[model samples]
Target: MVSKAMHRIDQQVPVLPIGDGVARSARQQQRSPYLYTDDEIQRILHAALLYPSPKASWRPVTLFTMLVLAYCAGLRGGEVARLMLGDVDLREQTLEIRETKFFKNRRLPLAPGVMTSLKHYLVVREQAGAPTNPESPLFWSPQRNCGYTVGGIRLILTDVLRRADIKPARGAVGPRVHDLRHTMVGHRMRDWYKAGINPQSKLPYLATYLGHKDIRSTLVYLNITPGLLQDACERFRKNGAAAPQTRESLP
Candidate 1:
């Protein structure tokens, strides 16, 4: 096998070309995460709510609730898919995410308004007589008799983006459910800057909130956008912060 040959060559050559090429390819193929503006988020949510009759009649409420949670909580699609009925604590305004990405558990506090919306969704679910057992999925699907699959959610999200008239150019990646997390981070960072808070100091808390094992992992979620860049630069100028001058080392 090529892998075995690579192992053998490692002992002989002290280095491998395969790994370098793969790393280079990965760097070249990396795509930026799509960041949604406030208007775009509202538009997408509206589109989901307006999803056509019949098939989507069963889904509008569920999809809208899911979108709110994804954007507000910055939950990964898989984490959102795995939520159990007992995981959501309306009284405490918290979500218990268990055995997530790194086999870690975390509690995420909800915004007051987001909590209210979730309470409304729960009331509707109860009226519909959807399952309420502890083991039952928080987001139930009438079609699946269980929680929505991550892939299923992604497919639905793609359709919603299309309906919202959001299309990525040719050969470019479009918005996805996961991008909601990125958008959440970006928006939060922008807000922190505007509020005169040091985002760097709060990154550890954000990492914990997002269930990332290390701060390094959380950094990947923070993408720089034009608006974020402009706002940050303006804040810096307002604060009278100066760029550090670099000193050349003597040759």
Candidate 2:
């Protein structure tokens, strides 16, 4: 714009063409998400539970519970970090995720097992002298006396992943904290297939549960895996044979 104005003011001024000869940079390929198996998830959780820290007694349990919520509830790391005490309702078995990505708010029903785990964590959190006020962070950092930051959550999870032998000690290539969300989606779809349910029909519900603006956004997480493929293939085989077939005469 400055160049254009200068050229307008002075006929002698040359407005060199911008981006005329420049080649557009190639779009970087997005890394394939690592879909975690049930055993791998258990290992990661176990590593978190055993994470040793002398100053913060609540660290181990806090990390464990956070991972559980991330994987089981398909929560984004920020959503997990931003949870307030009042957001969780043990009696109702629900979690109220406040303003998140795209400035959206959502409430999610917790599975019974997840609720039980959370209840156990709450007991531990209270024992550790965490503030019980409704506004206080659910996953409090005793050292900081505040909620864990999104970056902090990722770093901690990375360390746990290393301990669990799920990732290299020093590298960017590994199962990320965000992969838990993908894993949750993949696992849920696989389960639906095994149960003889139509996963396509359930996509919108999953999208809403994950706080996605639309099913298209949710579709990115549904990477085909061996187990999911097997179940899907089985479903197709059984249903394909029974599907009504019509004969059409050729012109």
Candidate 3:
């Protein structure tokens, strides 16, 4: 977790620098991959989303809604804290990010599958007589003034991670929400590749869509795997390039 002191600094820091670091990491890791094995990430997100929790009478709908928004929309923990009852448009199939952690605004396009689930959830919400106003918060917790906190998001997934028994490879960092952001980027890149999309050119669009200030901030999500790394090394040679290496985090 970022200490409040760190958060204050990050808030003041220019986002482009963050993007630069992200891009440099990707370039540096061309020889060695610096990411979870695909299976590990898949296991973590699925387990977290599926793990059952003690639902309030309205929790089933709220929980499902939160999962769909977080996974499909790629919202950060704080943007989610600001989700309002009317921020979502089930009919329009898009949602607006008012103000985000990095101070970027975006409109996340939704697909039909997610829309279907969201509609189901909204119905339950309506049955429970929830609000449909832009003013009212979409997800409220009795404990929080506005919405869920970083710690809350962490606890939610940590409990599920324990259930799934997913651990870091020896000497790897434990998984976290930012990891979910990484996983989503990796998944999208794979999809673009499969669809004959030129990843280099497509990256800017993806960056904008993901609410990144610039492509550099978005490129960190592109750290490749061993097989992809081998392919890069065969074509491009960079002096002193590192494999995607991860430093160990203290337990």
lDDT to native, each model = 0.82, 0.89, 0.63
Kindly list the per-residue Cα lDDT of model 1 for residues 8-61, writing each as its tens digit.
Answer: 868654443457777666854586788999999999889888987584355777
Better of 1 and 2 by TM-score: 2
lDDT of 3 at 26: 71
- Ten residues in a row with the worst lDDT in model 2? 20-29
Q: Kindly report which residue pairs in candidate 3 clash with one another.
A: 19-217, 32-243, 32-244, 33-244, 34-244
Better of 2 and 3 by TM-score: 2
Q: Report the C-alpha lDDT of model 2 over 1-251, residue by residue, as the tens digit.
A: 57889999997888877673342222113677899999999999999989999888778988999999999999998898899999998778999999899798999999999998899999988998889999999998767877889899889888999999999999677788889999999999998998899999999999999999999999999999988989999999888766644223333
lDDT of 3 by residue, 92-173 (tens): 8888888875786777888898888777766776666555667777675533435556667656655555556664433223
What is residue 121's positional error in candidate 2, in angstroms? 1.0
Could you say which candidate leads in lDDT?
2
- lDDT accuracy of residue 244 in candidate 3: 30
TM-score of 1: 0.81
